[model samples]
Target chain A: MRDKNLNSKLKNNFGAKANDSRIYIFLVIVFVIIAAIYPAFFTSGSIKALVSTSLIYIIVGVGFTYVMIGGNFDLSIGSIINAGAVVTMGEFNRFYKIFGGVEGGDSALIKAWILAFACAIGVGLLIGFVNGFLVAKVKVHSFIVTIGMLTTVAGFVYTYSHGNSISANTYSLVDVIDKSFVKIPYLEVFTPRFVIAIILVVVFEFILLKTKWGYDLFMVGSNKESSFFAGINTVKKVWITFIISGFTAALGGSLFAVSMNAAVPNFGERGIAPLMFVLAATIIGGTAMLGGSGSVVKTAVATIVIQSIFSFLISMGMGFDAQVLAAGVVLGAVVFFESFSVYRQGLKEGERPALVLEAEQLRLKK
Target chain B: MSSDNSASVVTLKSNTGKVSFNTIANRFGVFLMIAVLLVVGAFASPRFFSGANWLNILSAVSILGMVAVGVSFVIYCGKYGDMSVPMVMALSGVISVEFMRYGIVPSFLGAVAVGAVIGLINGIVIGKLKVNAIIWTLAMNFILEGLIRWSYHGTQIYPDMATAVTYKTGFLLPLMAKLDPNIMNIDLTMRAENFNALAQTYFAGGIPLMLVVMVIIMIIGYFIQSKSSYGNKLKVVGSNYDVGNMSGIRATTIVMLAFMISSICASFAGVFITSVNKVGAFYVGAGYDFQAVTAIILGGMSLSGGRGNIIGVAGGVIMLGLITNILNLFGVGTFTQKMISGAIFIVVVAVNANSLRKLGKDDA
Candidate 1:
């Protein structure tokens, strides 16, 4: 009996590992299919561009991964990105105006950058704190709280900006943002943004796998009641995750401004395409939708997959509508298949039915 | 001991009077807010209490009320309500307008049938297969919006030709010709004067037919949720799926029915709203999902489900409409209106959480 139990546990770990690799396998298949149609997709230049475009979202999505892995939703991240973008840009411009010299120099730009960064990040932390306090401390549903935050923040951003785009003084931001300290073997035109994404993935993935805090966070996500009973500070852990989520999303916002040199109102609008993309990417990255587990590296790769899908559809003469539909179709298919596979796995395991186990647990609780 | 506890809960003068206060805040907050808003509105603007403006507020929120009532059922079933309501509304309206060549009533039926079909898809996937309703419906929202944009080439569908009214060849031609219900007592500009009469027609005493229809739907919803066995099954399943399943309730079927009812309501709202605009576009249904969800939550209904009622939901919807009207009278901008509503959403949800915490319960 002990041997059987050990073997099952081993198989479960091995199964999860296999599933993690499955996303990359699927991504490779997608690449191969695209390569068959367009040889240029295999070229280094387009690959670099693909990573460049997905880089910002990878930052936002990595933050989102923290919240999701900790078992929470942050629908307000898109709005956070909006607020961050607007604040950083608006603050940068305001400071730039005050500090501008007849002959522009780096010192003035550096000052603006520092102030802008502080204000932007401060705003994100504030919002994240509010979301965390309400969800963790007050115990409101994260979904409802974040939805309200989405609207209220968007309303404020719109009110402040008057629904117009704010363009910033870019040399200071561009010089720092565009610098590439690390080089890849094959990719010649790699940017620092790509490096930042890789670093975030590696660092966070390590923390999640190796740290006690990470384990507790997952425990909380898996079973909040049990985690609480086990003496985990579930509320604190959950609240901290929201802050990280907001922080990363806000970081992405500043990067967005740096890349575009502008904070456009479009991101905060109802389309919420960025939020949708991150959500789709996170789930596609092999994150368990019911929480308890996710991989930062896989999420990064998933971002690439989505970015490729966007280009693939566009290259095939499909319009923006096709791209939108494809997100829905792909997300829907993944979720449905995940559920189906779970159902099939349940039957295969011949374990007690989930409902029966749940019933038993309820009785125990009572 | 139970009677002593109840007596304390009932009497404000009791030692733990705060319990009574919390009970009222949790249970009757929406109704109280509606009453307060009515008083505040009369004070804010002379037009607020007038018969004509009151009718306008009813008309303005009629579509929203219908959708919210349906969403309340979805929330009651603990599915987080349908996120695809906006898309469903837009798609159904567009379908109705596109199929007008088949005659008016058939077109309406066909449009509503599309909604039912979409709901069926949602039901099967989320209910039978046990998928997450919020994500699935959100995906459906995207797919439906994409389909609309793809089919229409990102253009709004008009009523055949600049809405040029023609002498109807059908049986009701004389009635439509004599009465352009577009001009009937509503303050809204008749943008769709020649579009359709079903949406425009007013009942006796100038009560818009749409308001009447909405009230009837809410009444039916109240009965179904409060009185019907189906509703009891829904509450049982929603509160605890395993318990409901073990007790022999058809949990999947109840869930499917809830989704269908929600979609059907969206379809009804779609037809009415599309006629008002005289054009069908994806953007037309853009904000209804959030608004309806807000209204449902504001109605003192629990998002975790199996609590609150249709009457409270109606009060919630009316209160929203009333606030917007009062804001309009106060000369506040639309963005400010949204901010206030959004802020209200957060406050109300926090209060709701506080109330439920006493039972050692937390809503999703």
Candidate 2:
């Protein structure tokens, strides 16, 4: 019996490790195929651009993974990003005017940049707190609350910017951050944004995998009642996840704003596409939408893979609508296959999914 | 022991009373809200109470009401709501217009056929495959939107001259003339007139045709939902899929039927919308899915499903219409209007969650 137990344990561990590496393997295969189709895709410049553009999604995907793993969703992340961008740009412009339009070498310029970053992050935290409070304390559904916040924050962003793009000639600080450095083979370069995104992915991955809080979060998500009974503060953990989600989204938005050197009122108003990217990245990274398992590093890699696909599509001369359609198809196909696997597993276990089980219990009680 | 029993009985009586009161309030809340809005509108703008304005409200809400009714059907089956409704509406409208040269009946049938095909896809994926309803429908929406946009090459299609000529001198005019000779006089050439004006044509006592159609649909919806065996099966399936299946309810079939009904209603609304706009475009049904959902929730239907009625949904539709009309009268911008509606949606959902909790039916 002891030998049998050990063999099963080893098998389970190997199975998990294989599952974890599946996304990376898939990504590698996709890269190889793309490179075969377009030799330019393998060039360093194309790679650098893809990584740089994917950084924003990677950041947002990491944050969203936390929320999803904690059994909630933050649909308002796109609006948060928009709000962050607008506030950052608007504040910088306001500060520049306050300081007599100083161009460079001024303490006022630094102060303005600092204030803008703080304001952007602060707005994210505030929205996150509201989302957390509603879902945790008020017991409102996260989907509805976040959707409401999505519209409300979008409205505020438009109102603040008055449907205009905020632009300033004195965006030297942002420009510097966008500057590429450390050229790799084939003339590819990394930007500060790419480095920052990598650091965040590593740091968050460590936090989720190597901390007690991470275990608590997963426990709370997978079995809230048991976690609560075990004296874990599930509500607080959920709240913190939302705050992290909001903060990451804001960071992404601010980075985007700085890179572009402008913020438009209708920023992120294209609707659903940004959110879909975040979701697709996280899911492709092996994060289950039903909650309780995910990895930030995997998500970051998944974002790059998705972005590379987008780049390939663009190179093939597909329009924005076509790209969106492709993304949707990919998302649906992934989810369908995942669900089918889970359904097969449930059948093997001789049990229904939790949702059906809960519904059955509720009916029986009546 | 007798005194304790008596006290327990009193508490139980009060509890039952409170439950009934809550049920009543939930059922009539939208109507109460609408009544208040109507009164306030009358006081705020004299024209709000005018016959022309009422006709406008009815015509505007006719399409929305149809969509909301369809969403309510899906909700009744415990599927939350269908995100594909808007796309289905747009697709159906586009298909009908694209097939207009094939004649009116054939084109209309084509639209309905498109709806049926989409519905079948959604129902199979969500029902038999048991995919998440919202996500699956959302993906389906994107696919439909992409197909429509690709086929149209991002261009709008107007009614062809042949169809226009037919409307002018063909069966439509004669049908209208027979329905109301006074309204369809020779002075009004159908070719030069807006097709929507036909929808606005009044019957006896100045009742708009759209209003009559809405009333008929609502009555039929109410009967089918509240008085039919199929509805009973749907409720059972929605209430508990596993239990219903165990009890031989064919839960998958019931769920698919609910989705089919939803798409059928959406197709009908699409035809109406096309008639109203006289043009087919990708954005024709934009925002209707969310709007319909908001209306259904405002009608006190639980998002978890197996609750609410068509009458309540109509009241919700009217309440939304009044709110928008009042906002427009006050010159509120689109952003603010969206914010207000979104806020209201959240509040209603929160309240619904609380009620579900009280019933000990929290999904969590």
Candidate 3:
């Protein structure tokens, strides 16, 4: 009995670990193919650029993974990003007006940066609260609520900015957070956002794997009624996930704005692209769309894989539209493969007997 | 547990009677809102009550109504909504115009055929393969958008003599043209003249041609949804997939049929839109997907499906058109209008949800 228990336990552990490691293996395979096709992909400059751009997606993907795993979608993440970016830029402009011509004064710049970050994060949290309230309390479907919020928030952003891109002359303020660290030869690149993204991934992964809340989230996702019966506040857990998702998307958006030194009202105009990327990353990371299963670390790695594909396509001189098309194809192919594998696994796990019995019963009745 | 069972039974008894009441209230509620809006519009602006303006509103929403009818079918089958509708619309419009050399009948048929093919692919993937509807359709949308863009090299195609000839002999011309001899100028071979005549043409009592087409489609959609065995099976499948399968409903085939019907309707709408605009562009059908969805939901159809009808969807299309008209008359900017519509959509959905709960109806 002891040996049997040990054997089963070992099998379960291996199975759980393999689910995540499979994505990593796929990522490595993709990297190898890309490197072989374009030897320049290994260059430090290319790697740095890819990481810098991918960090934002990774951050958003990590947060969105929580929402997806909790059986909900945050489509408003794109609009939240737009709102965050625009709000941050707008605040910066306000600070600039108030402190007119700071002339390299570090104090004034630091204050401006602090204010911008607060405003961005605050707006994200507020939107998230509303999303959670409606979806949980009002019994509105998350998809409709978030889609409406996407339009409403986007309109607010455009209205606030007068449908214009806000360009700030205060490079000093943005540069504080945008600065790089530890330049390593030809790979010298912006490391602040990359570090932030890495920190978020580690923190989220820890929370998702090691905490009771994480377990509750998965339980609620897999079966809400069961979770309810188990005394878990599934609604509260879902609300928390949306808030985290919103907060991360906002942080990433604001960071992007700071890096670009401008925040256009329509920055998230490629509305579905960021969403598609987040979903693709999450799913590619072995996250089930049906909810209840996913990993933050796997999602981060998946983001890298997707980003690498885009970077490769860019190097091949593909335009934005072509890149989008390629991403769609990749997303479709990944989901298709994942669904097929899951189906096959089900078939292998004694589902065939039940299915055959059902079929035979139908035949007999006919 | 015994009390819970008793309560559920009581609710079930009350629900049977309330179902008809709820349906009537839901359908009537939209018209009531429209009436309220019409009254407000009349008071707000004199032009709102004009026959010409009413016709404008009807004609403007004709394409949307057709698309909503298609979307309603998918929703009826419990497939939330087709994200590929917009792309299908654009592609079909482009195809119809592109194939004008093959004559009008063939071009129209070709456009619908293309739509059916795309729908078949979506149906097979989503139904047979059991893929998530939203993601698969969304991916299909991207692929279609890319294909259309690449094919046209991101340029718009204007209707030419061939298109004009096709329109002239097309069945829609007589149905669309006004009864007045002076207004129904069908002989105009010039593209602009032909388009203007078609645009200005209305049936007796000033009913637009597209409106007539919309009504015909709605009737057909209603028949397929309510009268046909396929429709009955679809309702069963939508309400409970496991139950449907147990009952030998062939849930996958019904879902595919729903998608195909939706695509066909959207294709017809595409042809109508291109006819109205006199141009076929990749962006021609942009934003229609969301608009149709909003309309479908507003028309009393739940996103969870298995409820609502084509008539309700028509009311939704009309409601949307009326809202736009009212907003435009008030000199609201497009952005503000979008914000208002978004808010209204949420409110409608919330109320619908509350009503559904009160009715003790299961979502899926």
Local accuracy of candidate 2 as per-residue lDDT tens digits, A89-110: 9988887777766644577788
lDDT of each: 0.80, 0.78, 0.79
Query: Could you give candidate 3's per-residue lDDT for residues A1-366 as a string of tens digits?
Result: 545554564466776567668887888888889878888888877888888888778888877999989988887888888888889989987876676547647677777778888999999989888888778777777887887888888878878788889877667645655456767755466577777888899999999999999989999888989999999998899888888988998998888888888998776344236877787888888888888998998898888888888888889887766665677777778778777776667666844444555576679889
Q: Which numbered prediction scores highest in DockQ against the true structure? A: 1
Could you give candidate 1's per-residue lDDT for residues A1-366 as a string of tens digits? 545554565466776667878878879889889989988776766776777788878998887888888777888888889888888899998887888832458788888888998998988898899899999998887877888898888887787678888888565567657555556644544576667677877888888889998889889888899999999998999999898888888888877887778897558343427777888888888777778888788888898998898887777788775566677677677778887776677566856545555666679889
Return the TM-score for candidate 3, rounded to 2 decimals.
Answer: 0.87
Taking the tens digit of each residue's C-alpha lDDT, what string does model 2 give over B82-174? 988988998888777544543556667878888988888889888887887876787787677766665555656565332332332321334
For every model in order, the fraction of real contacts preserved is 0.60, 0.38, 0.42
Best by lDDT: 1
Which of the predicted structures, 2 or 3, would earn the higher TM-score when compared with the native? 3
Sorted on TM-score, best first, the list reads 1, 3, 2
Task: Point out the worst 10-residue segment of candidate 3 chain B by lDDT.
Answer: B166-175
Indicate the residue-level lDDT of B90 in model 1: 92
lDDT of 1 at B142: 78
Each candidate's interface RMSD? 1.6, 2.2, 2.1
Query: Candidate order by DockQ, highest to lowest?
Result: 1, 3, 2
Q: What ranking emerges by lDDT with the best candidate at the front?
A: 1, 3, 2
